[model samples]
Target: MMFASIASVALERAQMTRALLLRMIQMAEMRDPEETGPHVNRVGSYSIEIFEKWGMKHGLSEEEIDKKRDILRMAAMLHDVGKVAVSDKILKKRGQLTEEEYETMKRHTVRGARLFLDKASDFGEMVSEMNHYHSDFDAMAAQVALNHHEKWNGRGYPGHVDIATGSPLKDYAVPDYPHKALGKKEEEIPLVGRIVALADVYDALSTKRSYKEAWDEAKVLDLIGKEAGSHFDPELVEIFFSCLPVLRSIQQRYKEPEMPSE
Candidate 1:
């Protein structure tokens, strides 16, 4: 009886921590109108769906996958949290950015990664105090933030830095650090990062943004299919298509407000 009571309290506290983290993500992204909606929620949901369908093929047991699902959902939200640091001029620009502006924009990936890594110990302690649950997910979340921009072919950025190595740097704004290109191939990227990458791209392509109308769902899927080996994990792409119905249902449920015709 005492054990049950302790377990219940732990679960409640964990829930609270998750809620707080998600709210933080929303607040961080509120600067950009395009990101202020259900974008984070949809990406998290889409990642959950993808993992549910394909996690086992990656060698995780059903129980392990189930345990990690919530963590995956929450961590996915922070994938773009570094955008908070980007300038409004760039983030809200309706036109394409100049080369310099685009380069600056990519710094968000590294910035977001640093947000978690820098605070990992503190975050772990807080979660432990709140829920008495020991979770390594803070580190995992940092990895997802760092690597979500990485491509299967290794072309993505802020490119190929081994973020697992701790840094003494305190200023998150300055991205000038020695980040070596480790030359990671498809399987080398963390599985969670790969999953969120696909979800992020899918949501971005299928939804209307300030610069463009939403592409037709068929076109989006076709592009994702075509980019399988180079842009995405081919096996995960198959899993994505195999679970099309659920993905569509998720899309409809989180349907963005329609843009007025120009």
Candidate 2:
């Protein structure tokens, strides 16, 4: 009975820590108010739905999938936390940025990763001493943030040298800034990262932004199908399609609140 009580208190404290971290992410996103919709919440829901379907089809036991689902869901929300470091002129721009500005914008992925990395470095020891589960979640969050921008065909940004070729930026010149490179592709990308990538893109396409109108559901699904093996993992994309009905329900439930017109 005493052990049970202690465990309950630990769980409550963990939940509080998670809530604090999520609020930090929200504050960072508030910097670019126009882009901050219900995106984080919607992406979290979408990722869990996709991960569940994909896990079941891939032969993962229900227990295994259930154990990691919440962590993955929470981590997905931090995928864009690095954008806080982006300049207002670039992040809030109403029009296309020049190549230079776009390059600067891409640094958000690295910056986001750095934020979690710093957290992991600072609190990792303390969390591990208290609860390994919390430490694991922090590490997973960092990984998802770092690799969410990676592509299946290896064309994604914050490029790293392919270990095989020893060439980091084969096509484009290296950026002036420092970045981490995982050199992951397809199944190589962490499942959590892959899930968040699809969720992120789906939410972005389905919602309206300052630069473009919201895309129709059919158009968005068609684009997902078209990019299955290139922009997304083919198998996960199949699972995503299978769960479209549920995905749509989540979309409706967390539908972005209408913005006031200027």
Candidate 1 wrongly placed segments (more than 4 Å): 1-5, 120-125, 128-134, 162-183, 259-262
Q: Write the per-residue lDDT of candidate 2 for residues 92-201, one digit (tens) a residue.
A: 88898999999788777667666654645544444454476676777788778777877888767665533223245554444663333435677767778888888999
Clashing pairs in 1: none
Worst 10-residue lDDT window, candidate 1: 165-174
**What tens digits encode model 1's per-residue C-alpha lDDT throughout 1-262?**
9999988988888778877787768677787677745788888899988988887666878888888887888888778887887999999888989999997787777777776666455655566566313255676777788778878987666555545442223332224543334334688788888989999999999988878888999999999999899888888899999988988898888887766899
Q: How close is candidate 2 to the true structure, as a TM-score?
A: 0.85
Which residue window of length 10 is worst by lDDT in model 2?
161-170
Report lDDT (CA) for all predictions.
0.78, 0.77
TM-score, model 1 to reference: 0.84
Give the number of the best model, judged by lDDT. 1
lDDT for model 1 comes to: 0.78
